[model samples]
Target: MQRWPVLLFLAWVCFLFFAGIGLFMSGFLLTRIELASSSSCSDPLVPPPWERQSLPPGSCWAPQRFAKAVLVIIDALSFEFAHFNPAKTSPLPYENKLSFLHRLATSQPRHARLYRFRADPPTATMQRIKGLTTGSLPTFIDVGSNFATYAIQEDNLAVRQAGRVVFMGDDTWEGLFPKKFFRSYFFPSFNVKDLHTVDDGILQHLYPTGKHGEWDVLIAHFLGVDHCGHKHGPDHPEMAKKLTQMNEMLRSLVDHLGNDTLLLVAGDHGMTETGDHGGDSEKEVNLCCCVLSKFLIPPLPLQEPEAVPQVNLVPTVALLLGVPIPYSNIGEVMAELFSGDGDAVSAALQQLSVYHINAKQVRPTVGLPIELEKRRNVFLSTDLFCLVQVGWGHDVIFVGSLH
Candidate 1:
């Protein structure tokens, strides 16, 4: 071949390779959705607290149920690990380990609530954490960026609370919310074999910070369970050991927390039988959310426990902490947590009204405002009287789902 022809062929190959790389990068960048933040407290899209009559309709604040909150994330805590099944004569190694949660739910029925927390697909830690904080679902492509997480741009629970957040464990959090926490003790989370470093680091600071009242929202993300799951599948003896450690730590933490401090224990995601997660398998998606506080009322126990979306934790935490709901939140305020005695009708109506604000915040993205309006009107016209009579406050939230 002539030199000129050989050089031309090499040039063409390089051009094609670069073009393909450019196209692949562009595809992910284009499909990646970045939601606009609510920005200022005065933004029209933000909702005012239920009690503040002086503030306009769309303003900052929501009813604060607790003066402070401590969110403990036990990574990869599957429902089976946390839920106790009386029917199972022979339980697995991971099952019935976190028995304290069940005991708490039974002993303090009015003060504690437990739910099967269901995660959206792409249940990587970073993605699940994003959903847990932002009240938004993750795209499938987001899993690719699990290790290389960028700071979350959208208005999130951590940023809403801002300088009041104290965090430790899972350096992924630092990557996800850089400079957001008032005080932080980050431990490298990528080493699956080394579990105790992150968990112990969190323990060193978690209770001391909570006792001192230096933070309005204390966040501790434990990685031992997830690390154990990754290193030795959920069937291993190490899994039981880790869960027992978690149970003991939780009991001590509960004793340490004051009545005014709300403690939210959540699993960002779960693992499969083989201890792999990323996909949308039932075992992978089903996790646990145990909310403990003197400020809450437990829902009536059902034959089969109901599951709540993990993203719902965002609005639930935001409202419980008296912060404005994020602009992109799709989850409704969990009514079971907010239900109380008093003027039942008035309370139901007041809670129902928050759905209108939720609906408005989400309306712009769904692109079916007219249809949503028509469906909402139909619900109001047909079921308003029935809903009021029966106090079906949750049904009103279903109406907001029209968006």
Candidate 2:
């Protein structure tokens, strides 16, 4: 054989051998990490196993009871922003000020509850939305390049259970849920020049026939805040103006809908000083949860409040809509929020306990296997982070900082 040909053959062999080894290592690490991450909490706060609590046998739509639920999620609205005002009395130096947001924060029917959890690790729009819609965190470690595919594959279980789910926002909003499962009302986030136009579109859809009885669940996400935050930092004048605008938009919805609707206002994640997110940075991922409605939203109370964890949103919403929760759901319904006697509350709690813990194995301690699994694969790659921007506008580049 010629010398050059022999050398080329040797190089090819070496490349194949190394590539094979690398792939095998990656797969092994992933499996090991997944296993380690599966440890059940020893003495886990398992809700009591399931007991049947039937709603009074009657029509689904009653005058006193809500026939529908509307969840309005404001992407990137931080709890810090919701509670703190740097320019409390002073006017912000921006043309499109967030006066509406400030007014809503101060004047709207509001509930503030301490959400107990570190900010979501996959600190991006789509991943957090997935967390809100489905009770599950992103499955992959790194933010995947093909996030839309992953999100649909994972599916938003909560949205699927609703009678009718109308999602109105940027195309990214459409990517978060499976297309086949839900009827989506999509709009180009980039096309609309005005935020109120988007809001109007949502209002029109909700009242297509000038009636609110159509959709069982209406989720409207306003992307301007997050959009502005990415271009300018969250604390920037431009961002503040947009926040105020969004706040006003929300207020408009509340004014139109009145007290009968439960309005949930939340930010998927916050931005950092650099106007970037995708790590577990405390500031980057912290969320703002503001519930404006006659009903008690999580962390808030109709009466004496109890400390429920942040994960409770999934089951709580599910129970209220009278939907059957999946076996994988881990959160419990906050029974204490309903206005009723002690016996009624106890029954609700008991019913919630049964729903949360049935068919799930209880692990008292964080098992070594589970911990190892999380440390290795779950935390190693950036698939989960990639999922955050699955249907987002920006190009996702892994800077190798899943530290």
Candidate 3:
């Protein structure tokens, strides 16, 4: 009888042990894996540009396009708000609110390109920001960590340009970069009820800091549109007022921009019909990205805007500023930013070379089978970057040569 009792207790212990192991394994498997590779400006693996033969390994291949760049984040500025639908006889309050953007894109087609910047869901701000900077996709599990802002572990755009970076608005940047900026102005973004505090805070520092010319890259994140969306749905009168304010602010910012500067405006994510996000609904994922500069000329004239993956921004921004692309970036340089007018072949070659470096950086971690790796290596070694012409066809024409 006593031995039976002992056997039962042993069985119970074994059950608990196995259950604990299973539980730990389940939790470990469920957690999202973060990429940990870091890249420096001097990495020898990245090849020098063909024309820029004297360039050292990992040295910036393309000449810097702009002396300065301004990145503006208008949270929750959806496609509906950015695009003015002509077909609707009576438009919603949120519709046609950003007249300035549409007008500029139409009037100065070469200078301004508006795109439907599609984000990987869950479209919460933090995850979107991660995707924007790191060029990595987020798992659904990341949505839960929206409130808990952790420092970015991977190589990011901000860190690569550290000390030369200036940041304003959205304290989330403060959390993610943490002393990475040369100058920073941050406001609490948690209070959804108050809209002006963050916007006004950005307004106070935005122009003055830009005029100071102390930084290379200026990042300003505006939360008014998003907060208004959260407090009152996009259809409300208040939403119209908020968007109008944004429109005016953008106009003023453009006036302040010199020819030497490039202006990049993007919505981190869009809101649903009810003005909530963090889901994969069409409205929530379709946001706006506008790149404007006196020098910029797109491959196509501004007609209806096209959709682009959000990750592409990282390489585009990096190359525009003459910086090394982040080591783990999986995105290709967006072709629309370059003009194919007289230099289509050169542009294609530059893009292919950039892709080759990006491929070299990312391939080791993907763990392809040995045979596949050999084939990929052979293809890369043989200047098969030219093969992109055959594979991409019409797409390569728009990618303006960097050399």
Candidate 4:
């Protein structure tokens, strides 16, 4: 063959090799979501305090924090959907359609507040819920568990509070909690093409069930917001309509709520601009965690919403209701929710500090003050020890999930 012909053949081979590599990289980027690893259940450093069936004293862990709790999860509800309703003075180009949640969070006496609850990557729904309910970090394994047939064996308060806990919405909970609900209207969460099925079923049943007034806990998870995201991207017209519908339903529920009831609304994970998730970008991981009630949570947090770990809710919920923190929990107690009798708040903080120290069995838990708890339950503090023990990449990893 002529020299020119040979040279062209060689160039073609090189192009194929590089193209093959590029395709492989793209596939890996699109499908794999793992960002961190976790300690095995048998990891020796894990103390008994962080295991199943163990109890750590919580300052607000008392008997019956409220008469009831209602958790309404509007899947894929991003921070912008619920937290911001730019006033006329604001400069964003689009005409701002106000959400009912905005009204509730900023009402004269403030019937509710919205927080920027952070979510970890893999932003898959199941992994997010596992993190939310168990107060546990998402392991790289959760990527598999998101589709695996395995049952979640971790301690979950929603399951523990089973007898009177009513559930309606995504069937994902059916798989995760498996027979833990008292009365349930489990609707299919798949089928993004037919968006209304799950939401309609949930809406039809939710109000009637609430009217019955026979449960201590009511959990209603809406799938429409997420289905819209998957089908039409974040900027779809249906997105706003779905959010508006959710706000109306929730507002109605709050209007009828008795003095002792608390309503919590949150997104399991946020969607990317293209309406897909499983990444660590802000739009994909920042969602809203809102609380509503007839009475004010004293010493309300900042007037504007603040960001906090999604895991923090586990301990916060446990403390609010006087339930024990899950044995394997790593969540911090959220302090801004409750107004203070300084001493009581102090005691709760101390409880969390002690629990943190004992759970990891490593020196002081990272980010906690050394003087906060004097308990010498486990390992000594060291820079490397803290990072390795947390499994969570940094001091801050989690916020709210769409669940």
Candidate 5:
């Protein structure tokens, strides 16, 4: 009886052992299959040499040299929307006190430059962000496939901002730059009816990011302004509240940022007077772009207040952070921001144009020589920087207003 029990126990052990081996083999095979399927012809991690083009001599991405950056994107912020001059808009004394953004831009040791940015319409959030980040023109096809998920195959500035990049707010960026950030917090962009939650949700992470000091780039995309624009027009009661929140947050961010870190704030696109977009009306296409850095020379409105194309920022930010311009970029670099050697600034622009031509990415009106000429002009000018005129490409009455 004892021998029979022992034999039964031995049989059970053998069964368990076989089951374990089978599980291990199955797992091993699945992993191999998964790896095979996921593998790409060109690994983004280790791209081809041609794809990794060199920047100009001194313009390579070195966050160590420039310190890290904090990009605050306030969606649908128009020229008047962010205006805090007290001369314009209502509610008089109460609003301007909270509106340090007004003082920040206009004050001495001025860290801000407010510009009327000309955005490409279909000025939808995705399209604007694509232009802002990739420095590429998003076409009719992009608008047609706005909802579709597309992997970013072209060289992007994110590759330069790759390590330790933290993103919060506006889930749209995740789709725009999938698998890119080290840590991210994405909230629903569609929930416009419930206005405050998305902005508030992103607010929690803001100071903590400043405290930790680990992230090389901290991107905070506030959706409150856009949500307010959608749910209630620019003049709605809630809009004031939202602006107050943004103002407070901006002050906090300024306090928290290291001397090395640059603070860049801009709208993805502007809202119309009636609070809607996707048209070329001055209010809709015209938005504000502001950059604050101790390294920057004072006298806000950097260049006598002219309209710059939204795509221009892609190379501007990349150059500041020591990254190559996105390969497909057609916009000219904002060389005026740098007080460095004009030769190096011009060289960076030339390199960017050359790379675009080599990669065959220049499109429509802007060509390599046209881009290089602007660079050369900026290079040659004694005082005034060269200005490359921007071309327009949007239907006048493109979309029905949200109103």
Candidate 6:
């Protein structure tokens, strides 16, 4: 070979080596980023909006009236993802179907509610999870170690009130709740060599025959889809394969549970190409709620049919449980879903709004008084309340009261 060709070939090989290295490093960092901000279950220092108040048991109104148990699964879910893709993603063909997911999305007695939020700069699993569990976004951007903290700690008065709560997932599941509270069953993430075995352990515990009414609240996190998405992007065949597996697993469990148990299937956060989150990507997060029982409330009209966001989820689940909507939750309960009675739900929602506004008015304990004034305009602009103008767009001031 000529000296020049040899040199060129050598250079090309060196370039390819570094390029491969770069890609691997990027994937590693992306995986770590997703796990760090999105998957951890502990609450951050500032806490999210929903985590602001711990409702004393039975403080609001509704408590375990509609359904006996609650099941929450956060999909590769972004608030923006749900807003963008209201219709279901195209399903795989017969041999490749996600039977459980497909059934949940399309079946009767299974109502799906899409919630839209007014918050800006939406992104990340932890933030969305905080919003779902608490009713508001996290006060600070980087708070919350995982979803369990929001479920057990924070202001999860509903979970506390439940007769029993069971959480199943990877190692992160262990961190979401305090050991003293709900009985937690954990499985390591799919990245572990024996991921399926861990899942089996969980399924066995949850579906042990002859064991009835074991748990009042059950939250299971399936990591296969999320893991595959992170490792191979959302559109990849591997991702779809994992989703199919998850669907099958869920369907089997649901069949085992039968009518007495209500199955809720949802995603924690969605993923985009480039394998990264924390930005307002349309695919960053999307969640779907599928109720397995015939007793669920029917669907309700979407306020702004065009702008479906994710924060609406908290209110929907609260309504399903017949729990009084908290004062801070902005979304309305699907009136159609209530068993021919919406008065109590409506009244409870009003009270929740009152509580939210009242809570905001209280002086801040952590920040300086001057800082509060500086941020007043920003706070007022939030979806929590609006400043109205009389006559012309002048003499603007906050208006509206629940009482």
**What RMSD value applies to candidate 4?**
8.9
How well is each residue in 1-403 modelled by candidate 4, as lDDT tens digits?
A: 5999999999999999998877654433322122122222233433333223343332223334566778888888877777664555752311144366776667733467778888766688887887777666554353333455545665666767323889899999998788877888999887987688999998888877877658878888899888888888867677777776777888677766678887888888988877888777999888888877776665463354356777777766765665555655566666555433456656456455435433452232443345323211112221212211232323432222111
Higher-ranked by TM-score: 1 or 4: 1
**How do the residues 1-403 of candidate 1 rate in per-residue lDDT, one tens digit apiece?**
5999999999999999998877655443222345444534554554444544554332245456677888899999988889987668887879888888899888887777678988876789988888787776655443222446567776678866434788888999988888878888999997899879999988887777777757778889999999999999999999989999999999889877888889999999999988889888999999999988866653453443367778778777776666677765667666545545546675665566555555555554444446533332122222122121111122443332221
**Winner by lDDT between candidate 4 and candidate 3:** 3
lDDT scores of the candidates, listed in order: 0.72, 0.50, 0.72, 0.64, 0.63, 0.46
Q: Candidate 2 regions off by >4 Å? A: 1-53, 57-66, 84-87, 90-119, 141-148, 181-183, 189-213, 258-260, 295-310, 332-335, 338-403
Looking at candidate 1, the ten consecutive residues that score lowest on lDDT are 383-392
- What stretches of model 3 exceed 4 Å from their correct place? 1-30, 45-52, 55-59, 86-89, 140-149, 301-306, 339-341, 364-403
Clashing pairs in 1: none
Per-residue lDDT, model 2, residue 348, is 68
Model 6 residue 400 CA deviation (Å) reads 20
TM-score, one value per model: 0.78, 0.63, 0.78, 0.70, 0.67, 0.57
TM-score of 6: 0.57
Clashes per model (N, Cα, C within 3 A): 0, 32, 2, 18, 2, 35
State, as a TM-score between 0 and 1, how close model 2 is to the true structure. Answer: 0.63
Candidate 1: residue 358 Cα off by (Å): 2.0
Poorest stretch of ten by lDDT in candidate 6 = 31-40
lDDT of 6 by residue, 1-403 (tens): 5999999999999999998877654432221001121111121223234445543453333334355555646446333322322254774221234444544444543343433333222455555555555444342322234643443244442353344676766555454444733667677663632325455555567565313646656776655555555666655666556555665666566655644455555555555665456565555543444445535444443442443344445555554454543333333343334434356566455445434432332222443456333332222221223333311112343353111
Error of 5 at 391 (Å): 6.3
Give the CA lDDT, 0 to 100, for residue 310 in model 6. Answer: 49
C-alpha lDDT of candidate 4 relative to the true structure = 0.64
